[model samples]
Structures are given as C-alpha cells and as structure tokens.
Target: MSRIAESFKNGKAFIGFVTGGDPSLEKSEEFILEMVRGGADLVEIGIPFSDPIAEGVVIQEANIRALSAGATVDKIFDLVASLRKRTEVPLVFLTYLNPVFNYGFSRFFQRCADLGVDGIIIPDLPYEEKGELAEIAAGFGVDVISLIAPTSEQRIKQIAQEATGFIYVVSSMGVTGMRSEIQTDLKAILEVVKGVSSIPTAVGFGINTPKQAGEIAKITDGVIVGSAIVKIIEKHGENAGPYIYDYVQSMKNAVKELD
Candidate 1:
C-alpha cells in the first residue's frame, strides 16, 4: 500500500498541518516532529505563498510570517530533506499551484520523491486541471490528493474516482479555519465518495476540539486539523512545541477512541 493509504489502515487518521517556516524553519521542523510524537498519522506542510486564496486570516498571517522569515521553496525542500532523516511519518505538502509551476513540476516532484513526501494538496487546482501536474507527479510516485468541497455535489463522484492518495472533504463552503459548527451534510457527500471509490476520506476545514474530532471521525476515515494547530503555534511562537504536542495528543486520542 502507498504510505498515505497505510496511514488509514491503522484506524482513523489524524492529519495535522502547519506552515513551513512559520516563525522559522527550525521551529517548523520542531513542531512537525512534535506532531508525529503526539500521534499524527500524516502531516501537511504548507509552502507559504504571498496570496493564499484558500486560507483564512490565521493561515494567511502564517503565510506572511513564513515569507517574512525567508521561507522559500528550496528552503522548504531542505526542511523536508532534514525531516526524512528523523522520521518516516507520511508528509504531504499543502500548497498553491504557482509555486509548483515556478519550481518546475518535474523538478518539484523529483525532490518530493527523493525526500520522502507522500502526497500533496493543492487548494486552487481544479479537478479538471489536475492533469497539469497529476501525470508528472504520478511518475515520481507522488499522489496528487483531490479535494471535494460541499459545493462539489455532482463532481464528488468524478473527483473521487480519479483521486490518488486520499480525498480531502471540505467540511463547509468557505475557506480553511475553525468554525463553531460545520453545517454541511458531510455524511451525504462522503456517501457519494464511498460509492464511487474506496480511497480513504478525511474531513477538514473548520475542525477543532476533541468533541468535533470524535464526531467527525465517526463518519469519516480521518479528521484534519490545521487552523486550530496553527492558532496554537501563533499564540506560543517559538515555544509552541510542547503545546503542539499536547494538543495533538488530545486530538489524536479523540480520533483513536473510534478504533
């Protein structure tokens, strides 16, 4: 099984996300390791972009912080290279398409393959346009994960059928951030995906708290927590490691209870 697929086999996966070079690349590495230590089955490293259209204020500010701190595509690649020496936990990139195109798809995916990145999640890349990188990425054994939003009613089946790795089910209609409640009919959307594909599905966007995680885990194969963790890092800055570890441990335990 692919590393991404293997992550879901153990039970409901708890996927954690943090911006690469937020505060600093060293700190980013530290936080990622802490997430793994706390029980993240998979991790997504955001390659900071100037205009992260899919991000809310929390992550948008994180992008700015990372960029101001001199986060570069090459630097992020080096960060992943360093991370591979320490852990084998699945690492995925949550990035926009411009950076990948600017870095050159073949070179980018080659680096990912060499550095042990399991998959990638591109928010703005439409399912129809995924061919722009999907073929190249697959050549290097990298799965181009597909995102199915609440608005993607008819397209959910089509996206699921072609998706590699796992499908990211957006829990609401808006961008990424924590919400008081996810009002989408996620169970129905997941039902469509399951009908067409057996690939694991993880619900993200606005998911925070163990109660929310456990509730979502009962319906999906996994739960992805990004903004909530980013908020923790934002509040603590360089000293966010222990806080991250504790928070992730609680979130992971929440998901683990389903097993």
Candidate 2:
C-alpha cells in the first residue's frame, strides 16, 4: 500500500500543511519536522504559486511569503530530499497545474519520486482534466491525489473509483481558509464516496481547531490542516516549531479520543 493509505490504517490521520518557504527554507524544515514528531501521520507542503485559485487569503499570503523568500520548485525539491533522510512519514506536494506544467509533468513526477514524495495534489486539475498528467505520475510511482468538492456531488463516486493515493474531500465550497463552521453536507457526500472507493478519504479546507478536527473525523479517514498552521508560522517565524507540535498533537489527540 502507498504510505498515505497506510496512515489512515492506524486511525484518523492528522495531515499537517505549511507552505514550504513561508519565511525561509530552514525555518520551514524545522517547524515541519516538529509537526511530524507531534503526530502528523502525513504532511502536505505547498509549492507556493502566484495564483493559487483554490486557496483563500491566508494561503495566498503564505504563497507570497514563500516566493519572497526565494522559494522555487527546484529549491523545494531539494528541501524535501533533505527532509526525507530524517523522516519516514509520507510527504505530499500541494501545488497548481501551472507549476507542474512549467516544470514538465514527467520531469516533476520523476523528481518527486527521486526525492521521496509519495503524492501530488493539483487543486485546479479537475477530475476530467487529470488525465493530462495522471499517467505520467503513475509511471514515476507518484500518485496523483483527487480533490472532491461539495459541488462535486455526482462526480464523487467517479473520482473515488479511480482514486490512487487518497481522496481530498473539500469541506467548503470556497477556497482554503479557516471557517467558524463547516456548512457542507459532507456526511452525505462521504456516504457516496465510501460506498464507491476503498481508498481513504480526508477532509480539508476550513479545519483549524481540535474541535473541528474531531468533528470531521467522524465521517472521514483524516483531516488536512493548512491555513491555521501557516498562520502560526506567519506570526511566529522560526519559533513556530513548538507551537506546531502542540497544535498537531492536540488535533491528533482529538482524533484518538474519538476512537
């Protein structure tokens, strides 16, 4: 089984996310390592893009911060290689279609395999359009993860059928940001997804607190947290490690308590 799938086997996976170079590569590495140590079964690192269509202001600003710090695809790949030597946790890249295309699909997926990245998430790559790189990704042993939004009612089953790594269930209709509450009919959505695919499903978007994580865990295999963690790094910079550990630990604890 792929490492990402293996994570869900233990319990509800706590997937932590942070833009690779939010402030600096060194700081990013430090904080992300803390997240792993704290109980992140899997982690998604953003490859900062100028126009993150699926992202809200929090992640959009994080992209700017990373870019300003000299973040590049090549640089992020190197960082992942370095990080791989230290941790066995599954690492997935959260990026856009443009960057992967600009880098060349075959080349990008090859680089991910070389660097130990297990999966890739291109939010803008629709289910119908995923064929653009899905074949190439599989050739390199890198799974192309699918994102199913609330609007994707009929398509959820189709997506789950061919899903490779895991299904990223987008909890809200809008972009990535912490919301006061998740208003989507995810319970019904998940029922369809679970009925069709055996692959694990993890909900992302608008999850910030442990309460949110615990609540969502009841329906899905995991929680993907982005904005909240990135916001912490944006405020704390290099000293964000301890805070990341605490937050991830709490979220993990919440999931465990549900069990």
What value does the lDDT take at residue 98 in candidate 1?
97
The TM-score values for the models, in the order shown, are 0.99, 0.98
lDDT of 1 at 27: 99
- Output the number of the lDDT-best candidate: 1
**Model 2 segments more than 4 A misplaced:** none
Candidate 2 at 39: error in angstroms?
A: 0.3
Off by over 4 Å in 1: none
Error of 1 at 234 (Å): 0.7
Q: What does candidate 1's lDDT look like per residue over 41-70, in tens digits?
A: 999999999999999999999999999999
Q: What digit string (tens of lDDT, one per residue) describes model 2 on residues 1-259?
A: 7788788888789999999988988888898899999999999999999999989998899999999989999999988988988998999999999999999998999899889999999988878988869999999999899888988877888988999999999999878898999989999999999898888999999999999999999988999899999989878887888988999999999987776
Candidate 2: lDDT over CA atoms?
0.91
lDDT of each: 0.96, 0.91
Please give the TM-score that candidate 2 achieves against the real structure: 0.98
